[model samples]
Target: MFTGLSAFPLTPVTDHGIDEESFAGLVQRLAAARVDSITALGSTGSYPYLDRAERARAARLAVEHAAATPVIVGIGALRTRDVLELAQDAQDAGASGVLLAPVSYQALTADEVFGLYADVTAELSVPLVVYDNPGTTHFTFTDDLYTRIAELPNVASVKIPGVPADPGAAAERVSALRALLPASVTIGVSGDPLAATGLNAGCHAWYSVVAGTLPEPALAITRAASTGDATAATAESERLQPLWELFARHGSLRVVSAIAETLGLLGHPNLTRPLRGLPDHDRAAVTHVVQQLELH
Candidate 1:
């Protein structure tokens, strides 16, 4: 079972290319922190911005540094063939699994989405994680579609983004999905803000962004929630409310990049060009939250 926290680190970038040293350092840190798994080339990794070669290199580097820790590499692409090739590359790179989100230039139909996974599953030998992050992909997965995808040969887990507006509703949704999925299909929640609620509602794992930079706090919430301690989980969530507000105001990519820079996790928190880091004011806000939480 793919349970517990899966840390998705920001892909550190330098003028020349991927900051390989810094990237390895981040992965090694997460491994030392004992995160259940690590995901490279994920949304935060800026996978879409990189070319095929860059993505492949990032996957290999992550797998190498991850050592004993399992690494799940994001293989999402707009085209079916591209996704298939990336999955094969990930498997060859020694990744434990591959995560796929139905990212499309045009909105995809249900059958088209199903076909995409089916084709990839046919090619991939590693476990497949269905990433239902409609916020970024603009491709929502219906329960029927989820069930269909989960039935695929190598589909082992689904990363469900939380419904942030109403955590109660999100918890209920998690419970419903839990009942709907097969016993072998692990239900993990992304959307850092909703992780505690999702776990309390019985999610087996947390696909976390904040954990990439601050594993301790993220782990605290997940551990408490996983053990059925709703009070402790809620408390930790409340403590992170300020940071969550920033994430809501700005996207996590911006806030998390800023936090990473503030903590000196990267040489600089430079994301791929065209996607800049947070402005001065927002960055100050992140710094304040990090200090208040004593995350640094």
Candidate 2:
């Protein structure tokens, strides 16, 4: 099971295609900073925006740069075939695991949700990390359904969006869910700023979008919290709080990509093809937040 702070890098796209050079550089930087894991082509990575070929290239770049560190590939899509295809591609691309969101073509019943998971797991060779980011999928995961999915073969972890407003409560909920899951399975939170607090609350680890832009501070937060230094951890989290707010302030997947572009981490902010960039005002807001954080 992967644990601690795992950063999710933005998948930078140029006018032609995936910017492998920039993407690899970002992954190398994060690895050097000692982030626990990295997710290639995730929500922050703009998985939905990328075509299959681009997603594969991004995953391969992340795996290559991550070296021994675990690299998770986001494999959520509306179609089961697409999800399964991406899952297989991720495995072939050397991803250590895959993160899947429940099918959202329609409002799926719990049984349908469980079946979709089972189908994906059956086709997958690597361990699966189920994602419960309701904000994106428009469907929330019930604890009972998670318990059942955890019992399936190759289901090694669960990824829930950390309730950042009340991390303690989120952590408690994670701990309670852990009890229902198999002892071998890990509980991870996708809430970046709350990672330190979530770990303190018994979450085994976190998959964070903020880590992509600021690996040093993000890993510092993870280390401080994981090692039981609440004072240091809280301070680190506070420092990065400004960046976290950007995710909400700007909204959607575009903001994270925009921040990466402004930082010069990516060659271009062009996401996939049709997705737009941050407006001048929002870009100014993001730039201001970035300057405030002063992450190096």
> Judged by TM-score, which candidate is best?
1
lDDT by residue for model 2 over 62-106, one digit each (tens)?
A: 988888888999998888889999998999999889998874867
Stretches of candidate 2 exceeding 4 Å from the true structure: none
Cα lDDT computed for each candidate against the true fold = 0.89, 0.81
Candidate 1 achieves a global lDDT of: 0.89
- How badly does each model clash, as a count of residue pairs? 0, 0
RMSD of each: 1.3, 1.8
Task: Give the worst 10-residue stretch by lDDT in candidate 1.
Answer: 162-171
Q: How many backbone clashes does candidate 2 have?
A: 0
Q: For model 1, name the residue pairs that clash.
A: none
The TM-scores of all predictions, comma-separated, are 0.97, 0.93
